[model samples]
Target chain A: MNEYNSLLINLSVFIGLLLIGYFVGGIVEKRHFKSILEREEKLLYFPVINLAPRRLVEIGEDLQIENCFFVSGLVVIGEDYFKRILGFLANFFGGRLLSHESLLDRARREAILRLKEKAISQGADMVVNLQLQYLSINKETDSQNANNSVEIMAYGTALKVK
Target chain B: MFITNIDYVPSLKIIEHYGLVSGSTVRAKHIGKDFLASLKNLVGGEIKGYTELLEEARDEAIDRMILQAEDFGANAIVNVRFSTASVAQGAAEIYVYGTALKVS
Candidate 1:
């Protein structure tokens, strides 16, 4: 009887945590997406290109060059408990993990927004030679406190033209 | 010094080259921060502690790279690139490199 009672308690705790994770994770994700959309619209006019210096010349536009500098932005996002459970199921089935996909998409967009903000602060006309680096850190499968986090870094050269 | 990620700086002429300069740094968060980050994983959002740690490490790496370029008597560095690696279980290494040049 005692063993059965302990099992019942454990199951209830597990279910309770799952419910909290689902509701809290959904609310947080929704708020984040709303903010991302609003910010993207505000920064839509800023031009960020991946073209090299030579390509700018090939474009045949007479740009009055003034100065240039480097800029970078970095962001780290953690996977929520609810999404992690979803990802595990997807992994077992050998299919796409859509939850993780949206996480990465958000991180990348946030990094780019930060980079553009820096370029604007430097009085840059446009950002060129854009580069991105994505990293997954602290993935210890055996550890209880495994930090399943993704880091995104966006960098580029900002050109101040006259 | 003027630093840019492109091969050339706009409106500037590279009169001399000083080869390559690079810098790297590895960092790990403190136990307290790591514990907090794990707790934050439950709700899932931006991990501000890890983000700040990485930004600080990257800045230090860039500063070291700039010092190396200065030692070479270069006034500028161009074609700068950044790379990151997981050196250990919880440590990250940030590496930056570029070509040092004298520009006017």
Candidate 2:
């Protein structure tokens, strides 16, 4: 009977934590995604879209001289976010926020913007072959520390419609 | 070279010195090769993020530049140079350019 009661207690805790994590992930991850979209909308001037459904006919205006540039930089997200992720992970057994995928995804989005800025400064009308790169600074030794960070970059040509 | 693929397209120009050409895009063996290169870097290794992308992009950019020359009726493209950027860890950009010629 004692053994069964202990088993029941452990099971209950596991389920409770799983439920809590999912809720946290839903909130935090959604916020990250939304902010990234907002940033992109404000920055790049070209008619580019994220993974732009098809690689055809981007719509925009006025033929301008094609220009190109490349941009890059690094940044860190504070421990507050980091702690939240950790806290969720510590509680998680299943059902939500399984990994740090959402966090990484947002970083990629921002890095691309840096590259776009570099291209735009060159007075490019559009960018082509756009790409993203990342270097995880906090994956290990610094994982949970506030100082942990990563580098993010996006680059492509700025072109003017000919 | 300027892209003529845009709406207000222009006809290909053939130069006496240079031969028939419209525009060319360079194809690279290393599509996402940079990612591999970074792995090679390991801990304390120099980051060569822009190497692959820049190399490929330069070639493509150059091919396009030459094509642009053809469109302008230039016989040859001269003074080609390449510029590169390590936009981020996994991404790179390359641009190439040169003077268009129509030598008599």
Candidate 3:
């Protein structure tokens, strides 16, 4: 009887945590997406290109470049409890972890936005030679409860004109 | 010194070149921060502690690379690239490389 009571308590706690994760995580994700969309729209006029300097001239702007410097942006995002559980289930079933996909997308976009902001602040008209680097931290642990986070770094060269 | 990830800096000419310069660093967060990060994982969001730690480490790596370029008497570094690896369970290694050059 005591074992059954303890099991009942454990199950209740699990359900309660799942509910909290779903509601809280969903709200946070929605809010983040809203902010990302708004900021992206605001920075739409700025060009962040991956072209080298030589090819950049082909874009037809007679740019009398004055100064150039390097800029970078980095972000680290983690998965919520509900999504982590979903990831494990997806792994067991051999399919895509959709939740993680959005996480990555958000991180990448955020990093780019930050890079653009930095360039804008430095009086750069455009950013060129963009590059991205990805790294996963605390992923060495095989345990299910391990904390896993992804780091996305966006970098480029900012060009200014006279 | 001017640094960039492109082969050439705009409005500048590379007068001299110094093959390549590289810098690397391995970093791990403290136990307290790690514990807090794990707790934060329960809710899902940005892990500020890990982000700041890695950012600082990356800056340090870049500084070291710049120092090496300075030793080579190069005024600029171009074509910079970054690579990362997990050297240990909790440690990450950030490696940056670029071609050092004198520009006019």
Top-lDDT structure, candidate number: 3
| TM-score top scorer | 3
Candidate 3 local lDDT, residue B39: 73
The predicted structure with the larger TM-score, 2 or 3, is 3
> Lowest summed-lDDT stretch of 10 residues in model 3 chain B?
B37-46
In the order shown, the candidates' DockQ scores are: 0.75, 0.04, 0.76
Residue A47 CA displacement from its true place in model 3, Å: 0.8
Off by over 4 Å in 1: A141-145
**Candidate 1, A15-100: lDDT as tens digits:** 77667768997788889889989989999999899997668788886777777888988899888887877776775797788889
lDDT tens per residue, model 3, B1-104: 99999888778888999999999999987799888887777777778888888889889999999999999999999999999998788888999999999999
Candidate 2 lDDT by residue in tens digits, A3-115: 99999999887566545545653565567668778868878455543322123344543344433233333333322333344544665655555344455565566556655
Instruction: Give the alpha carbon lDDT tens digit for every residue of B1-104 in model 1.
Output: 99988888677788999999999999987788888888778888898988888889889999999999999899999989888787788887889999999999
Q: Give the range where candidate 3 chain A is weakest over 10 consecutive residues by summed lDDT.
A: A135-144
Q: Which segments of model 2 are wrong by more than 4 Å?
A: A1-38, A49-67, A78-95, A98-102, A141-150, B1-104
Number of clashes in model 3?
Answer: 0
| Candidate 2 clashing pairs, residues 3+ apart or interchain | A66-A160, A67-A158, A115-A154, A124-A158, A125-A159, A126-A159, A133-B90, B18-B75
Query: Candidate 2 lDDT, tens digit per residue, B1-104?
Result: 33222212122343444433433333332435444433322211122443333334544665677667767777554333344443443334445545555642
- Candidate 3, residue A129: Cα displacement in angstroms equals 1.1
